[model samples]
Target: MNMLHLPRIGITPDINDLPVPETEYVVRQNYADAISKAGGLPFLLPYHEPVGDYLDVIDGLLVTGGLFDIDPALYRQTSRKDYAMKPARTNFERALIEGALSRAIPVVGICNGMQLLAVCLGGELVQDISTEIDGALEHKPDQSASIAHHRIEISGTSRHLQTSAGEVHEVNSVHHQSVLPSDAYQVLAVSPDGVVEALEKKDGGFAVGVQWHPEYGVADIDTIIFETFLSKAREYSQKK
Candidate 1:
């Protein structure tokens, strides 16, 4: 049996207007498509109160990019800089991640999702790119609105069994805030700047996070990331 592709992804809600009224919750499309292309079943997990119960059944988790920020209060901060673009609560993110790690489930956090993963793992965020970098970056590389924005270099062997070191992957860059002072996760890849572009769990866990969005227009979708994540999910499902 194919034992490395059963994924039940959990997506987060953004600040966009949702199809439902009163309580708002809507998942992104590209994220689900990416998992589907990689041979995994995607579940659009709505922003809810109790997510702990679902952790046991989920094989893998995909934290996606969106137009919101995690409550900075979680990091013990009061300065509200870009509150408009901040993502919703998603308080269940860390719990889900820890749950996955405990059961040996694969995780792939994209963009802000990546940042949250870092924070959950005792890492700090850079907060504002304008303050961190000297010059502005062309976050939107493609004019067509369908291509990945920037480039990233995968420095070491990823959790994905197939990807080799020194591989340069083109990803869509679409955020102003990022994670900095990352210690818990291994610096897997980086962009031109000293800013970390990608990170992997150093504890031999099958998990990775990328600052860029690959679900939109990454040339090789199944190359390493989705492949490794799905493979891990399949493993988790089989053990059940």
Candidate 2:
């Protein structure tokens, strides 16, 4: 593919302290692999001061899934549960997303990324789905990553997902926090249990967030989402 044809995608990495005394910035290979497979150039981005520097060079942003929860304080809530969160990473992503939005570049947030995006847009989240929503389906599946644990109904009016509202589709689940409906974005899809599974910006600028990990690319809908996002990125790059 010509260099000009492929949009540059900036992907966020998770910070981890696995080995004693050593902090590592890591990102799952699937994110980059999937972006490359979808015809975009993937670049891993780490948390740093002034994220706008990174955003200035990329055509799009991909906020990947992480194991920690964003501090509830950001969305103006308190939680009793003690879950790990990286304040630095959260801060950096917020800046990055803001920069992307200012440029009107396409941005996709997966899993925790979705929560970040929602919270960034004045939305709250159910910190713990099991204890919050009654009769909610199992969201943190113990099964293999390749398996779909639940179904989501996409909205017909959603330009990002491009699926009917009444149409149900199966998807892999791997998160405990979910988005709460807010005026910042239109609820694009939801699980039968009422968990927000997908959201799109109301003004329609190709900004979307999904509760599932579409980087896994396990379903046809995943391909559609990424392709549409990349198309938007391509348009932005051309305009630049």
Among the numbered candidates, top lDDT falls to 2
- Residue pairs with backbone atoms closer than 3 Å in model 2 (clashes): 156-165
* Poorest 10 consecutive residues by lDDT, candidate 2: 155-164
- Tell me the TM-score of each prediction against the true structure: 0.84, 0.95
Q: Write the per-residue lDDT of candidate 2 for residues 17-71, one digit (tens) a residue.
A: 6774688889989899889988899998977878878878898999988889999
lDDT of 1 at 148: 62
> After TM-score superposition, what is the CA distance of residue 91 in candidate 2 from its true location, in Å?
0.8
List the RMSD of every prediction in angstroms: 3.0, 1.9
The positional error of residue 133 in candidate 1, measured at the CA in angstroms, is: 2.0
lDDT of all predictions, in order shown? 0.70, 0.87
